[model samples]
Target chain A: MIAEKLVQTYKVSFDQNNQELALAGSMRPQRAAEMADCVKLLETSLASIRGTFYVNVKRLVRLNNVAFHSLAGALLKAAEERPDIKITIITSSVIGWSTKKFGTLTAKNPKIVVEEYDSEFYPGQAFLEEGGFVPVLRTQTKLTWKHERAILPRHGLEPGMTMADICCGIGDFAVLVAKEFSPSRIVALDHSKSSLAYARQVASEFDIGGIEYIYGDAAEMLLEDGQFDFVSCRHALQIFNKPEMIVNELVRICKPGGRVYVTNEKISQCLGEPRGPSIEWTYEQLSKLFADFDMDLEFGPKSYQALQRAGLEDLRIESFMVTNRDGDAQAFADMIMAWEEMFAGGMSEKRGDDAAFVEKFRRGFEDHIAAALHPGGYAGWPVWVASGRKPR
Target chain B: MDLGAGQTEAGEFTLLLEFDMDMAGFTSNWSYCDRLSTYFARMISHNRSDSLLYSNLFSSALNELLETVYRLHAPTGSFVCSVSRNGAKDRIALTIPVDTETEGFYRDAVVVLNGGDVSPRYHNALFSDGPLQPNIGLLELAVDYAACFSIEPADGNAIRLIAELTLEASAP
Candidate 1:
């Protein structure tokens, strides 16, 4: 049954691509018709299979508006023909530029939700509204590829590994791990309800299984003792007003001999100076809380410090540089937009002018990217990923 | 051209200026430099046998000594006046200026007598032809000097020697 479904899915995708090619002026009518017929046969055979087919038709709209429409028509036809097989399509709303007939499908599949996500192509709400469909798809594709490449390392993940992603922001890493590592289970936990909701939608649309989306304070949620083999908290550790408590919680969830991985941008390095309350001050305050626990804390270079005082043992520190690059002008613009939002949102609670701060941040990002793109721009933002084990 | 060829005995002469006055009240009214100056002028005026040049030298030395004393002790509203006699042959003078701002007990005044080429004994006693004796009469002289002379107050000011005289005199 899985094979049959796979064949049907492959045929549908081929037909969609062929239709897109013909409309893009790259395929003749005869070739397009032949691919269409193949799609029909597979659709007929796989009509009984239960699953959802997700396609980002908006991506095609940029290469050829005609092809995008054609593919959209084919997807709608397939969905209508196979009532048993649920189909959903997602696209950035910026692509709303196409024929009005596209939006007409919103009524056909109430299960088919159209969400306008913050895409790598167009990061901010404004660009996501103005840049149209192609940039959005390009951004999403770039981001997806980035996350995939970053999390795919065998050393970072493995099968049957149980991991917890705190502040999993749209589950980019969560989905990557789920798709690539085939982990036994992952709890993609976040404090934002909306973020988690979108993450769930994306997971379902991509048919990513084994990921449990949970919304709440990850630190507050109690886990069954020694349940997880590995626990990870990334990017979100800096947001916690009380990061030590969160760290303690991460340690608590992992079984003896289980690894706890935590990663965050050392803001001090990124900003070139300490901007807020000192990390050392916070660490010292938190270390007292974990004095009773037997663990070694090791701090990696570039502001990655292990909490040695916390009794965390066998600490290992590693460093990585995260660069956001898009190949073209629109892609770059979209990236700037997204980062502006992130900066504005992240820094809004602190003192100072939020707009100015975001502008400065955007400029810094561009400067960094320009340097990195050149032969000698080795200066990239550093991310510290450190891990420690709970003594058996 | 007789230079005391005939034996004519000159009677021993002592000049004493006496006044009935309150010591504390006079010191309170006068500055240390003023007292020193008065004593210097009186010593120069009374010693007629000394040359005008030697008298000036004595006054200048007294003034310098007063400045030095003011620098060291800086007594409040007090002064020192001294005179030296080289066995009735040579005269030396000294003075000390004090600051009214300093608070302390004013001790007894000292007088050092030294002879130049006139008296070998005077030189031997002072060890350097400078005065080495303390005299109670100089203390009286200091009080009389304070009573008779006008000196700008040393009040936190730099001490200075206002006069000097360089004179060579043979034994008289």
Candidate 2:
């Protein structure tokens, strides 16, 4: 073959402070000579670090033999030259080949360790997935679905459209969509293995088929470009520090004429009657609590601007308030109680909130639950849903 | 029938994918290896336990073989890559028009693949300086992916190269 040089689609950066060399994107250079500059940079990065040089390849999707050979040479050379230093390669299990490809190096040098960065990625959310959160999440989806089932059509979801649900949590919404919309195909992906396991169990238990639940990271997915007709990332943007990266991936995998949809919460806007002030104060504190974890409880309103900035056209945006009166009053009350435990019981303690502040925070959720069950009172949680079409 | 280099009749196999093009067309650009492997991997990996993971591995394994053929094939003939399945085993068979020397290279590669242990040889070839060992890709498939290799006679001036793989282990 002649003239087989592929386009340079990878980026290499050295963070001197952390002693990290980060590589991202597809790397399939035809010759080892093509990677000379990168190898030189790696050699230079190694000389300055005294110990534990980090190589982060979490977003590196495609790597070929020519490039791997060059990378291995430089790394193994560093091990030989610097006897005291340890080289750690951090790979993402989401990328699939990362751990396997990099793990091979450990056999050659004990100090050259490969670690898959997963399981503990979310700061305060692992506890929820470990046990109690799954049923609550399913109930949460049950409550939200009542509003979303109608709202989705307004946001460009229709029957027979190929769909993908990214960061799909317990995957209840994907199942709901599969049953209602009959999408040609539905690929539901989430980062949590336990959540995906539960999702698969739910799907299997119900004898539901045509929904493929996969384990993957939302920020960096291996899905092909323009594969889906409608792609949705619901209630995920609020939890991520940088939602734009996930937004870009959502838009990328969508066909040019297809649409990208997302849902996020404005937690501070949650309202309850009869002791409304107490509920208001607690939610405001809840926003601050999430802020400490690098999450935005106020991301719902910002969904419009996020989709607009993603270069999408024909945008549709709206907000829905799910109230106790929408369906079963007890279900809504139960959700608030779970939130009280999650936020006040778990997060508030982590932030070291004092007994006095914690008592007041707990009071607000209790009041919201009281309002939900009052028969005369109202409790509400607001969510914003947005969709934008990729330019044709 | 020479039956050399672990060569044997594959018996009947169910075809999953097959690509045939003029040798010049297939080898005109090297990106064909990447594109073809990626497409084939994606198309077939959907039903696997972990579709993304399976595709990533299958693509890598196939790309190495495709690259080897792209590098070492003869000047003119048809290049054929066919994929088949026998239960859990996935088979990749490539028919390449080769000269006597290239045919010898394939013969010896299968021998080295079936040869006792190839991990050290694979590592040595990977870190070696100057030109790569022409059989390095075969060794990697054997050592890294645990692929079983076989060779067979084809039409005039051509040889069939086959690799059998059981990539994913059973889930616990």
lDDT of 1 by residue, B83-170 (tens): 3232333222222234433222122122122111222332222222222222212221222121112122333432221111222231
In TM-score terms, candidate 1 sits at 0.36
Q: Per-residue lDDT tens digits of candidate 1, residues A1-392?
A: 01121111111232342222112111111113434653464454345345655443432222112222344455566666766665544443222222222343555445444443313321222222332332433454354345435543422456778877766666667777676667776876655544555666777788766676654455554233466777777654554445677777777777788777776654334311122223233233223222222222222342234334334567766665434332343443454345444433333223244566445444554553444344433332345666777778
Q: On a 0 to 100 scale, what is the lDDT of residue B23 in model 2?
A: 84
TM-score of 2: 0.86
lDDT of 2 at A149: 96
RMSD of each: 46.6, 4.9
lDDT of 2 by residue, B1-172 (tens): 0111222335766777777788898888777788778777766766665567777778888989998999998888888887777767789999999998899999988988887899888888877887778788888889778899999988978899999988755210
| Model 1 segments more than 4 A misplaced | A1-156, A268-310, A324-337, A341-366, A369-379, B1-172
Let me know the DockQ for model 2.
0.27
Q: List, residue by residue over A25-125, the lDDT tens digit for candidate 2.
A: 77877788899999999999999998799999988877887889889989988998899899999998766667877887898888899998874667466
